[model samples]
Target: MGLQHTAFMEEEVRRGLDPKLARRFLALVWAQRGLVTLSVVLLFLFRLCAVATPYITKLAVDRYMNRPDLPVGDRLSGIQWLAVLTLAVLTVKIFTHYFETVVTQVVGQRIMHDLRLRVFNHLQTLSLSYFSRNPVGRLMTRVTSDIQALNEMFSSGIVALLGDLFMLGGVIAVMFSLDWRLTLATFAIVPLLLGASQVFRTLQRQVHRVSRAKIARLNAYLSENLAGMKIVQLFRREAENRRRFEGYGLDLYRTHMKANLYASVFFPFVDVMRAAGVALVVWYGGGRVVQEHISLGTLIVFISYIDLFFSPLRELAEKYNVLLSAMAAAEKIFGVLDEKAEVLDPERPEPLPDIRGGVEFRSVTFAYEPGLDVLHDISFTVRPGEMIALVGATGSGKTSIINLLCRFWDVRLGQVLVDGTDVRRVTQRDLRRRIAIVLQDVFLFTGTVADNIAMGNREKPRASIEGAARAVHADAFIRALPGAYDAHVSERGSTFSAGQRQLVSFARAMAADPRIIILDEATSNIDTETELLIQDAMRTLLAGRTSIVIAHRLSTIKRADRILVLHHGRLVEQGTHAELLAAKGMYARLHELQFEDEAGARGIVQAGEPSDRA
Candidate 1:
């Protein structure tokens, strides 16, 4: 399932141009019509100036420089004015080109900015299953390199291709008007130029498409290894991982070189063809000049126009690479945008009425994959203000239950109701606002302690943030730090210990002040002393709120109002701790295992005992 995106990327690359996708890209341009219009106007003016320069040169040579029929003074005066006119035309062309480049660049940046934001916002709306299936590196390529490719096309490829076409047309028109026979003779090499372009286009499509896909795979691989670098080092897999990375890097290098090889051959082939056209003009048009059948100025103009014609042809060949890459990138980016969110809000929603912290699972069933149910016919209820503990082995659907409760996932069968309303009846935003979950692996953003505590809500007063931290007993260590609440926290809060990070997570949950608090193995990783601190903090954090606790430590849940034991996705037992022990069922067996493990190791009876199950 994780490799599905890689396969899709490869397939999309192999596919040829899609008109539907081209139309979509055109629509993006249409959205910024004003900037595009200005760019086009500037480009037209530049092309006009480009066309005028050669004609002015012809006028200088024929009417002013060579025509003895005119007076010597008149010829001198006319030649000087022609030089001035030539300078003015060149100056206007330079300014128009500058403005055109600037406008196109602005359009490209604005479009890329809008597109990146759209992809980001769409990702946020997708269900957790989508993220679980896709790699972060692959998505990063879509938002970064892929969009940048489109920007390159917009900034340089599209407008330049248009300008090149116009320049070619303008040159051909003027040359044909001057001498049709010479224009036709010089254009004899057009067939060879066209043949080279066709072959290069085929090669470019194949190599560039594969190269882009390879880049995406490389990024995904790097992101995976870097994120798990600690595990790699612990397992002594550095040399092995590097070999794997080298393989990826080598694959990308070979693909790019293949594309470069095709370009290298094709570009010089264009130059040779351009030289062939120049030779035809020198041999054919030069003879006509000698026979007095054409002016020397007309022969020179023919040479100049031939250069103008082939120059754009060469540039169009170059810009085609950027165009192909942008097309492939657009397909991938649009694919992401088109992903259908599995969980969507109803067209019309029923609002929750006066939400209390009551929760229920009525015959709920779930599966992360088809035909593989993780939770089957599970039913439970938690009244407002009740603290219930879920006891289960790993893969026994404990976390799945929490996921459903939080609406991170929806049940496949039956209902998960909160405050007597089906969770699907309301927007996810409204539903999750009432629940705050603390997991065993706490995640903290890069910010100050207070910023993390407030969780990006600027409206959260400093007094309130500090009060929440103090409630979780995190204030003691926080105050000991350099800046106290204002201290800088590095990425993922790497500066904090596991226990300290957990304590801050508790503070975050408390700050939200949710009506329902979920502790999903929140204290399992803490040391004995740190656990004692959090155990005291939990009492205050969970007070007056409905709480659900999932833990491997049996002692932590001994004080729970009720305990439910699960095995293999089924509810096998439920009762108070002492009541379940007296019954001697699965719950009693788990308690016995923990009790034996703790007693044998420490020779001390302590409530802080670990269980072998989640």
Candidate 2:
């Protein structure tokens, strides 16, 4: 059993030294090189001083026992010298411990700080597609829980393991120096202790892995359900959600219980073994002392050494669990760090200067997944200052076209050109800076209303922010609030209505002063009153900029310079509202289907069928 445990530990250590883990661990330590080195040095010095204390005690015991007839002056002097030596060693031990703790904490915090920032920055650089595929809770776990686990490994686990190793070595050396036979006798149970540690560590690691996974799943479930609490409540799913949550909670509890069980059993087993070792040492060493083969001091020292040896063994057993957890966390964190950004700027890219907003898609084709094209080989052009409306059924590639034009994803075939220059030739930052997007699913950060509006233009003056808000007609409502521009917006802007958030987003886009603007279902969620307000804002914002409006409301597109109707990733018709209605094709059918109850369709027909509009 002892040999098996040793071999298993050796294997685990070998696995831990794998190139990837080694690099990550070493990098974390190297980040605080000065503190790490100091901690190690202090730990080594403290172990040396601790090892010498028992020897000093042994010397005093032997001198007192062997020199009963010594002169009083010599005896007193000898006692004083021993006392001084013991005091010195104890003082050094105390200071060493203090410094070790200080250094370890410093190193741990620094490494954690760097790791967290790297994770956050990488998350920001990842494409939207990656975010769409991963849940927010899962990502949060990597940043918070995983980094915290590593902090524990560095702050306590590493120091404990190192201190135990040094102490164990020192104790073994002193024991052998005192009496080899007694030392061998004391070590007879070492294999058994090692075996038990290995078994406990392996079981504990498995339990911890299960526990962490369960916790991650629970977090994900909680985040999802909370975000959609309204839907859940409306559907009367309280009991069902509770039942599901209970299952996840129970899974975590079971895993934690299993880990505790392993720990509980291992400690008691180790204590029993320790007791047996102490008995063997005292019985054997006591006999040797009676036979005068060894002094009483030697027996006492042997007993002390026995205790010292087991102390490290016990501590090592405990630290093994922590080490395993840290290793697991390191694997997860490095996996995130190793993820390369799929969307990166071109090397030696040309800088975009003064964009004219002439966007041309030349036979562009795209797909979120391979062999599944969302936008087929479609081509179109939007001249400067032209208002183009894209009308299509859901999944007709209208949004995909805007996405391609924005360089969110590059075209799989042909190219997207801005002012006859391939978008791929310039940096995404430069390209995006020239274009402003107002999405239907408006997102607002947690901050004051002014901060949210100025997000797109950080250097914009306060007056500019207020002016933009006024243009979108958001100023009236914003000022009506308690804090006006300073009113706090909660996360996701839940405090405000959907139409209000949309209007705020529009104001934000207008603040950026981009050459090209995209309104993606911008008015779809707004009421008629708000839509009319937004229509006026849109006309003002689009006056001198190229605009692409994706609208589900047919009435919104009737006044566009030209309307393109898409069906199944293909352009089925391109004409003004009146011309399309006259053509009596897909557009006319779609218009009648959507606006049959409204008088806007008749007003559109009454307007002259202008060719330039198409």
Output the TM-score of candidate 1: 0.95
Q: Flag clash pairs in model 1.
A: none
Best by TM-score: 1
Tell me the tens digit of each residue's lDDT in model 1 across 1-614.
12244432334465556788878888888999999999998998899898889899999999989889999999999999999999999999999999998999999999999999999999999998888778888899999999999899888788777888888889889988999999899889999899889889888887778778888888888888887877999999999989977877887788888888998899889989888899989999989999988899999888888778898988887788888888889888998999999888988998875578999999999888889898889999999999998886677778888888888888899999998899999999888888898877778999899999989999999999999999989999999999999999998888899989988989999999899999865454457888788877888889999999885555556778998888888988888888998999988887776655764653222222223121
Estimate TM-scores for all models.
0.95, 0.90
**What are the Cα lDDT values of the candidates?**
0.85, 0.79
Q: Which stretches of candidate 2 lie over 4 Å from their true place?
A: 1-19, 65-67, 71-84, 522-529, 598-614
Q: C-alpha displacement of 351 in model 1, angstroms?
A: 1.5
Error of 2 at 89 (Å): 3.0
RMSD of candidate 2 to true structure, Å: 6.2
Off by over 4 Å in 1: 1-11, 522-528, 599-614
Q: How does residue 4 of candidate 2 score in lDDT?
A: 29
User: Model 2 TM-score?
Assistant: 0.90
